[model samples]
Target chain A: MTLEEVRHLLDAEVLSGHEYMKKEVSKAFSCDLMSDALTSVEDRTLLLTGLVNPHTVRTAEMLDISGVVFVRGKVPDEDTIKLAKENGIVIMITKYTLYVSSGILYSNGLEGASILHN
Target chain B: MITIKLKYQVEKDDFMKAGQASSNLKKVLKQLGINSKIVRKIAIATYEAEMNIIIHSEGGSIDASIDPEKVKIIVRDRGPGIKDIELAMKAGYSTASQKVRELGFGAGMGLPNIKRCCDEFAIRSSFGEYTELSITIYHSGNNTEEGGE
Candidate 1:
């Protein structure tokens, strides 16, 4: 789904990269642990996370994630928002908890990124 | 035969600046026209190594060299080194403090994640003294598969 659709599905407010809403993201990965996110090999996916920090943006930058959705009504600080903007990562905020948010997106046809098998 | 070398000093306990070196490296790799897949791998490896220094070391430096064929990153730190290389290499072993864990890291996947993102990975350390990590990723643009431990 395109980021614009994601924003609508979650009732999310765009915090950064407002210009890139037309970008399409097919997969989604939801995790609070940055390490777990790093280990997953998924590109152009959307990251649904509860962790609000600069490193979240860094992780998105490294993995080439298309966008980030901060769930549970978490609002990132200015520095975090600025970093996301600098990295060209679109950021959005929603009131739905992480679990519910993931479910909503999944039910809307967003697939999960395949995990690397051991 | 262009070789670009970049260096950055990582400050201990400085979570705010933890990923700067890796971020810079990623930008440079993109500008150099390396494959996006290869660039992401290099970025993840370098960022993991860089965070290891910032979270565990007294201080350190990250040195990255981009050549036509491969990208190499060397992260060296002066601090408490790993006591068990084998144990530390495990996917879920970590010595990071609670404060570090609060930052959404320290899940013990750092080293393993770095290894997974690189073509070659090596580490050396002296307990309570220093640690060094070397990660290399080829630029052939076809080796982006997730590595098996």
Candidate 2:
């Protein structure tokens, strides 16, 4: 789905990269562990994470992730948001917990970015 | 042959700057028109190595060299080194502190992940002294093979 659709479906606030909402993301990976995310996430996937830190954005940049959704009403600090913007990654804030957000996205046809190993 | 060499210093416990070297290397690779897949692999491997220095070591330097045939990243640090290389090579073994783990890393996957992403990987260290990693990924035009010794 397009990021625009994701934003609307989750009732999220656009925290950065507002101009790139038209970008389409096929898979979503929800995890707070940056190591697991690094091991699993594919290019252009959406990262749904509760970890609000610069490292989160750094992980997205390293993996070429399309965007990040901050679950559980979590919002990144200024440095984190700035880093996301610099990396051209779209960021959104949502009130839903990680699990609920994943469920909503899954029901809407957004699939998980499956890991080959844990 | 003209090769590009870049050096970056990673500070101890500077989580915010952990991935800068890798990110910069990724940008350079992309600008050089390296294959996206190859670029991604290099980025992942380099980032993992960089994170290791930030989380586990006192400090380190990453030296990256890019040529037409391949890219090589060497990360060296002076710190308390791995005592058991074999066990540390396992997929889920980490000695990162609680603060590092809270950042979503230190899950014992960093080294394994780096090894998986490179065409060649080698590590050497003396306990309580230092650790060093050498990772290389070859560019084979279109069909790139993945493996390392």
Candidate 3:
């Protein structure tokens, strides 16, 4: 699914990388723990996280993840937003919780990123 | 043989600048025309090592030596080192503080993730003095197969 559709599905607000709304990201990973999230190797996966911090963006940057959705109405501080912009990662905010956001995206035909652990 | 050497200082508890070293190293590898898959592997391993220093040690440095065939990342830190290497290597084991956990790390996956990403991984620690990690990833051939064009 394109990030634009994700935005529409969740009524999310794009805080950065507005131009990337059309970027297709069919796989998503939802996690607050950066290390667990890093276990996945999928590229172009959208991260749905409640952790709003610079490390989140750093994790995405290292893994080549292109987009992040902040769940549970979480909003990142200025530094986090700046880092995401610097790394060219699109950031969005959604009022839904992480589970709901994941469910919404999953039911909409988006798949979960394949994880390395059992 | 052409080689590129890069060094970066990692400060303790410096959450704001924690990823700078790995980020710079990743850029340099990309500019050097390393394969994207290999670069991704190097970036993830280096970043985890860099973050481990920031979140766990007093301070440290990460050194990268890149040649045509492989890249080697050496991470060394002043410590308060790990007392139990076996337990520390466990995937869900972490000694990070609550504050660190709140930062979205500390799920204890750093070292394991690094090992998983690299072709060769070695670690040494002096318990009270310091810890060091050597990570290597090949660009093409396996570890045993060596030749030159």
Candidate 4:
């Protein structure tokens, strides 16, 4: 689904990068840990998490993630949102928990990249 | 035909600025007309490693360079050298503190991720001295039949 569809489905508010709503996204990965996403996330994936930090945007930049969804109503500070805007990563704030968020996206056809094991 | 030297001082315990070094490198690569996909791979791999150094070491430094042929990133830290390189290289081994883990790092895959992305990778460390990692990825090898590209 595209960013617009995800926003509508989750009833989320676009906290930043509304321009990126037209972008297409295929897979979704939910993790509170930045390292796992760093190791495993792949092309055009959507990252669902509760952590609020600039590293989140950095993570999307490195992995080329489609966008970032802040689950459980977590809202990042100004710096974090500003960085996301600069990096051009689509960002949204949703009230759903990580599990619920992941399920909604998954049921809607988003996928995780192949499990990369050591 | 040119070489650029860049340095980043990863401030200790500054989780907010974790990937600045790698991001700057990515910016430079993009301006140089490096392929977007390849730059993404390099950015992720190097940034992960850079974060590890800052959170694990006592504020380390990264020295990076680039040229027409490829991009190179060298991350050096004076933290206690990995007590066990083999275990550390494991996907699940991490020495990062609880706080670091809370930021989503210390999964023990930093070294492996760096190795996976670059065409040439090297790591050297001394117990009391420091740990230095050298990574080189030829632009051509980036997209070859090598999986991602």
Candidate 5:
């Protein structure tokens, strides 16, 4: 699915990389743990996380994650937003919890980042 | 036949800047035109090592040597070294405090994840002295499966 579709589905507000809204994402990994995200996902997957911090951005950067969806109505601090912008990562905020956000996307045919990679 | 070296000093408990070293390394590698897959592996390994120093050690440094064939990262930290290296290498064994967990880390997967990303991995530690990790990722001709995800 395209990031634009995800934005509409979750009612998410883009906080960074607005120009990349049409970016395509085939898989997503939802977790608060940076370690878990690092361990599991591959490059270009979307990260749905409630953990709002610079580390989240850094993790995305390391994994080449295409974008981050900040779930649970959480907003990242200035540093977090700055880092995401610097890396050209799309950052969005959603009012839904991580569970609901994952459900919405999954129900819409977005696959989870495969556990076989771990 | 040139090697680029980058060094970073990491402060203990400095959660604010824990991943800075790895981030900078990633940028340098990209600017140097390293393969994105190899750069990603190196960055992840180095970042995990950096976080281990900040979250567990007194302080440390990470040094990267990048060349045409491979990148090697050396992480050295002065801290209460691991008494059980084998146990520490386990997938879910972590000694991080609750505070660290609340921040979305200390899940005990750091070392294992680092190993997973490296073409060459070695770790050494003395219980009271320090711990050192040597991680190397080849630039090409690697056995790591690509496009598997």
Candidate 6:
């Protein structure tokens, strides 16, 4: 599904990259550990994590993620949002827990992110 | 035989700009036609090492050399050096200050992560003298540098 559909399904707030929401995303990864993430997700998949720090954006930058979905209603500060904007990454925030978010995306046709290659 | 050198003046113990050097090194490696996997490996390894310098030491600079077969990375800092290299290499062993822990890193995975990525790794730290890290990544021959920063 496209990022727009994911955003709509989760009632997410767009913090940046409004123009790129229509981009297609095949899978999603939910993790707070950036190191695990670096070696884990292989491609430009959607990142569903609650890290809420600039390193989240930086980690996505290194992995070339399609977008970031912050779980548990966490919102990025101005610096974090600015960093996301600078990297041209789509950002979404949801009130759902990580498990719930993963299940929702999984049931909605978003696959696990490991299959995508970096 | 293309080589690029980008210099960044890192401040002493400033965590905000810690990733700048590694990100730039990644950019340059991409432009140098390095493959994405190798580039990512080099980026992660060098970035973590550089962050250690910024978070634990007074600060340091990174020097990268690109060739057709390999990428060599060197990070050096003139600060309070590591007191125990053996202990430091153990995962979850950290000498990071309270400020470093607040950033979600410095959980003692820095050197181990670096070791996991590079083909060749060397570290030397003198007590109250300095710390320096050298890492090299050999091209796995995929040949496409396409990826994000």
lDDT, candidate 5, at A83: 88
Q: Which stretches of candidate 5 lie over 4 Å from their true place?
A: A115-118, B141-149
Clashes of each: 0, 0, 0, 2, 0, 1
C-alpha positional error of residue A97 in candidate 4 after TM-score superposition, expressed in Å? 1.7
The DockQ-derived docking category for candidate 4 is medium
- How do all models score by TM-score? 0.95, 0.95, 0.94, 0.91, 0.94, 0.86
In candidate 6 chain B, what residue range of length 10 has the lowest lDDT sum? B140-149
Question: lDDT by residue for model 5 over A1-118, one digit each (tens)?
Answer: 9999999999999999998898889989999998888886465699999999898999898898878999999999999999889889999999999999999999999999874243
Model 1 spans with C-alpha error above 4 angstroms: B141-149
Error of 5 at B119 (Å): 0.9
TM-score of chain A of each: 0.97, 0.96, 0.97, 0.95, 0.95, 0.93
- First chain of candidate 5, TM-score: 0.95
State which candidate, 1 or 4, has the greater lDDT: 1
What are the root-mean-square deviations of the candidates from the true structure over C-alphas? 3.4, 3.6, 4.2, 2.8, 2.6, 3.3
| Candidate 3: stretches off by over 4 Å | B141-149
Of the true interface contacts, the fraction found in model 4 is 0.66
Each candidate's DockQ: 0.60, 0.54, 0.51, 0.58, 0.61, 0.31
RMSD of 1: 3.4
lDDT of 6 by residue, B1-149 (tens): 55555666666777667677878887777766777777777888877877777777787778777777788888888899989999988877888776666566766777887887788999999999899888988984757755543
C-alpha RMSD over true interface residues, each candidate: 3.2, 3.8, 4.2, 2.6, 2.1, 4.4
Q: What is the per-residue lDDT of model 6 for residues A34-95, given as tens digits with 9 covering 90 to 100?
A: 65566543655789888888888887777767699999999888888998899799999999
At residue B58, give the lDDT of candidate 5.
96
**Model 3: which residue pairs collide?**
none
lDDT tens readout by residue for model 3, A51-76: 99899999999888889999999889
* CAPRI-style class, candidate 3: medium
